[model samples]
Target: MIWLVTSICIQIICAVHVIRTGRNQIWMLFIFLFSLLGCFAYLMLEVMPAYWGNRHLRTARAQVAGKVDPERDVRRAQRDLELADTAANHIALGDAQAARGRYAEAEAAYRKGLALGPGNDWGTQVKLAQVLFERGSSREALTLLDGVPEVSRGSEWDRRGLLRARLLADLGRDAEARALFEDVMSRIAGEEARCHYAAFLIERDDRVRARQVLEEVEQRARRLDRTQRVAQADMYRWAGEKLAELRRASA
Candidate 1:
C-alpha cells in the first residue's frame, strides 16, 4: 500500500511539472500511463538537461551582459559597496569603470581599493597609473610604476613595461625606452615588443636593423598560435604596416 501510494505521488508531481514546463504532450501521457518509469525518463531526458543548460546559459549571459552594459556592473557593485566596501569588490568595479573610459570614477574606485588596505595594492596602483597615463599624467604614472618595487616577467610586468616604454618615448628618453624594449624582448614572448623596438630603431636612422626587426616580427606573427594570434591581432597588423612602410622607404 505504501509503495503504491509513493509511486502515484511521484508520477503526479512529475506530470504537473512537465505539463507546466509546456513540453511535449507525450511526456504527460507517458507519466500518466507509465508512472515512476515515465517520471525517471522525463527527469533524465528533459529536466536535468534543461536545468543544467539554463545554468550554463545564465552564467555565460551574465558575463557577456557585463561587457555589453559596463555600467550595469558599476551599479551592482555600488549596491554591494553600500553594504560591504571590500577591497576586492572595489577593484573589480574600478576595473569595469576603467574599461569603459570612466577614468575619474575608476581612479576613485582604485584609490578606495588601495585605502581598504591589502586587497591588491600592487594591482590597484598599476590600474590607477594606466588611467593617469591615458589622461596624459605621465609623471604621476611613472611615479606609481617606479613605486612598484619589483619588475618581473609576467603579464603585469608587460603592462607596466609597455606603459613605461611609451612614457620614455613620449618624454624623449629614447635611449632608456630602447633599452627597456631590449629588456622586454628577453622577458616577453610576442612580436609587438619587437615592433616597438623596430620603431625606435627607425627613429634612430638604423634602417637596416629596423628592417631586420620588422621582418622578424612578421615571421613571428605568422607563427603565432590561435590564442596568441587573437591576443596580438592589433600588434600583428601594426607590424605588417611598419614592414610595408620600411619597404617603401627603402625602395
Candidate 2:
C-alpha cells in the first residue's frame, strides 16, 4: 500500500512539473497512465538533460575525471603540443602541468610559449610569473609582472595584480602589497582578493580587520546564486571557517 501511494504521488508530481514547465503535455499522460515508469521516463527524457548541463555537475564531472586519471589532461595537452608546435599549444600544456602542480614543467612550457611569440604575450608572461612565484622565485615573478601592459583590465588583470601583491607581501613589501590588494579587490566582485587580504591581515595580527573582511565575504556569499556559490565553494567555506576561528580566539 505504501509503495502504491508513493508511486502515485511521484506520478502526480511529475505530471504537474511537466505542465508547469511546458515540457510537452504528452509527458503528463505518459506519467499518469504508466505510473512510476512514466515518472522515470519524464525524469530521464525531460529533467536529466537540464541537470546534466548545470555548471556544478560539469565541474563535478571534470573533478571525477581528474581523480580517475590524474594525468589525463597533461597527456592530452602533450599530444596537442606534439601535433602542433604552436605557442598556444605550449601554453595549454603549461596550464595542464600547472593544474597538476608540476610547476617546473609548467614554467618551461610557459617560457617556450613566450619565446614562440604568443598572441597574448602578457597572458603567457603572467602564467610564467605565477609558476615562478609558486616555485619560490618571487623576485623574478615580480619582474615579469612589472612588464605587463598597462592597459590590461578585467579578470586577467585582477589575477596579475593579486599575484604581484602576494609576491610583494612575501618579499616584505607590506605597504606596496596592501595598496595593490586594495586596488584589485575594489575592481572585482569576487571574494578571492578579499580572502587573500584577510589572510595577509591575520598574518599581521590585525584579526579585527580580518574578521570584518571575512564577514563581508560571508555576506556576499549569502547573496550568491547556487552556481556562483558552487563555483567558489572552497573560498566561501574557507572564509566561514576562518571567521569561526577568529571568533573563537576573540572569545
Candidate 3:
C-alpha cells in the first residue's frame, strides 16, 4: 500500500513538471502508463537538466568526461605540464580552461603558450585570438591573428574569416567588412554565421536582407533533429526571437 501511494505521488509530481515546463504534453501519457519507472525516467531526462541550468550542465559534462577518462581535460593538461612545461602542454591547459568557460585564464594560458614558441606557433596565436575575440577585445584579437598565416582550408579558416569580418565591421571599415561577411555567407557558413550576418545587416540598416537571412535561419532551426535542437537551444531560441521581432516590426 505504501509503495502504491508513493508511485502515484511520483507520477503526479512528474506530470506537474511536464506541464509546467511546457514539455511534450504527450510525455504525461508515459507517466500515467509506466508508473514509477516512467516518473524516474522523466525526472532523469527532464527535471534534473532544467533544474541544473547551464553552469551545472558544464560541470556535469566534466564529471562525465572524468568517468570516461579518469584524468579528464584539465587534470590531464596539468599532469602534462608538470612533466614538461611545453607550449603544447600550455595549449592543452588553455583548451581545458576555455572548455570550462574560464576565458581570462584561457587567454593567459594561450599567451604563455605563444611566448614559449616566440611567434612560430600559428595555432597558439589563433587560440589566443579566439579568447580575446570572445572577451570583446576585437583589436587585440586582430593583432593576434595578424601573426598567423591565413589557412587555405578547414573550419579554422572559417573562424578566422568570420572574426575578422566582425571586427572589421565593428571598427567601421564597412567595405572590407561587408566583403568578408559575404565571403563567409558564400562559403555556406552554418546557422551561427547566418545569425551573425543577419545581426550585422540589421545594424547597417539593411532590414530587408536581415529579415531574409533570419527567416532562412528560423526555417533551418525548425528542421533540426531533436537532439541537435536540444544542443543548440540557446542559438535557436535567439534566432527565433529575432525573426519574430523583425516580422512584427514589418506588420
Candidate 4:
C-alpha cells in the first residue's frame, strides 16, 4: 500500500510537470497510463543528459553561468537592425527586444523601420503601439493604432485590433472595446485572431460566445498551413486553458 501511494504521488508529479512544460499529449497519456513506472522510464529515455547536466544540479560538474551572453545578444541585435528594410524585419526585431524586456530599444527599432518609407506599414505601427502600451502609454498606443487606415486592416492587422480592444477594456471603455473586438472578429478568419477575441469575450463574462469562438479557433487551427498551424496551436492551447479557468471561476 505504501509503494502504491508513492507511485501515485510520483505519477501526479510527473503529470503536472509534463503539463507545465507543454509536452506532447501522446507522451502525457503514456505517462498517465503507466503511472510512476512510465515517468521513470520517460526520464531515463526521453530527458536529455544536457538538460540534467545544468549547473543547478549540484551533482553535475558544470558550473553555473554568470549571466546571459552579452556578446551574442549584441550581435543578434545588430543583425536584426541590418535586416530592417521591409516592415517584417522591424516587427521581428521589436518582438525580440520586447521579449528581452528592452521596451525602449524595441520602440526605437520599430520607429526606425517605420521611418524607412514603407508607406502604410501597419505591422510596424502596431508593434510600436504594443511597445508604447507596455511602457504605460496606453492612450498614445490607442492613438497610434487608430491611425491605421482601413486599407491596412488585413489578416495581419487583426492582432493590432485585438490589442487596441484589450487596451480599451483596460481603460474602462468597455463599449469601445467590444466594438473593436466585434469588428476584428467580423473581418479576421484565423485561429490566432479568434483565440484573442475569445479571451476578450470570456473576460466580459460572455462564456457562451467565448466557447463558440474557441471552437472556431480550434477548427481553424487544424486547417492552417504548416507554419501557421504550429503558431496557432500554441494560441489555441493557451486560449482553451484560460477559457476553462474563467468557466471554473464563474462556476
Off by over 4 Å in 1: 1-83, 118-120, 151-159, 199-207
Cα TM-score of candidate 4: 0.54
Q: Pull out the clashing pairs in model 2.
A: none
Best by TM-score: 2
Q: Which residue pairs in model 1 clash with each other? A: none
lDDT order, best first, reads: 2, 3, 1, 4
Candidate 3, residues 1-251, lDDT tens digits: the string is 99899889889988988888786565687789989877765666555654466654554444533443443578779999999998889999999988777899899888888788656788777778878877889898888788788788767788888878888877788889888877887675468788788888888888888899888887777777666666656888888888888889999
Order of the predicted models by TM-score, top scorer first: 2, 3, 1, 4
Over 1-251, each residue of candidate 4 has an lDDT whose tens digit, in order, gives 99989888887887787678775445566577878767875565445464564333322212111121223444566786686565556666776677677899899878877887457877678778988988988899989988976546676667667788878977779899888887887776665557666777777889888877776665656676555554345676797687677567668
* Model 2, residue 189: C-alpha shift (Å): 3.2
Q: Could you say which candidate leads in lDDT?
A: 2
For all predicted structures, in order, the TM-scores are 0.62, 0.73, 0.68, 0.54
- The whole-model lDDT of each prediction reads 0.77, 0.85, 0.78, 0.69
Question: Candidate 2: global Cα-lDDT?
Answer: 0.85
Give the alpha carbon lDDT tens digit for every residue of 119-217 in model 2. 568878888999999999999999988887875587877877899899999899999999999899888768999999999999989899899989988
Candidate 3: the clashing residue pairs are: none
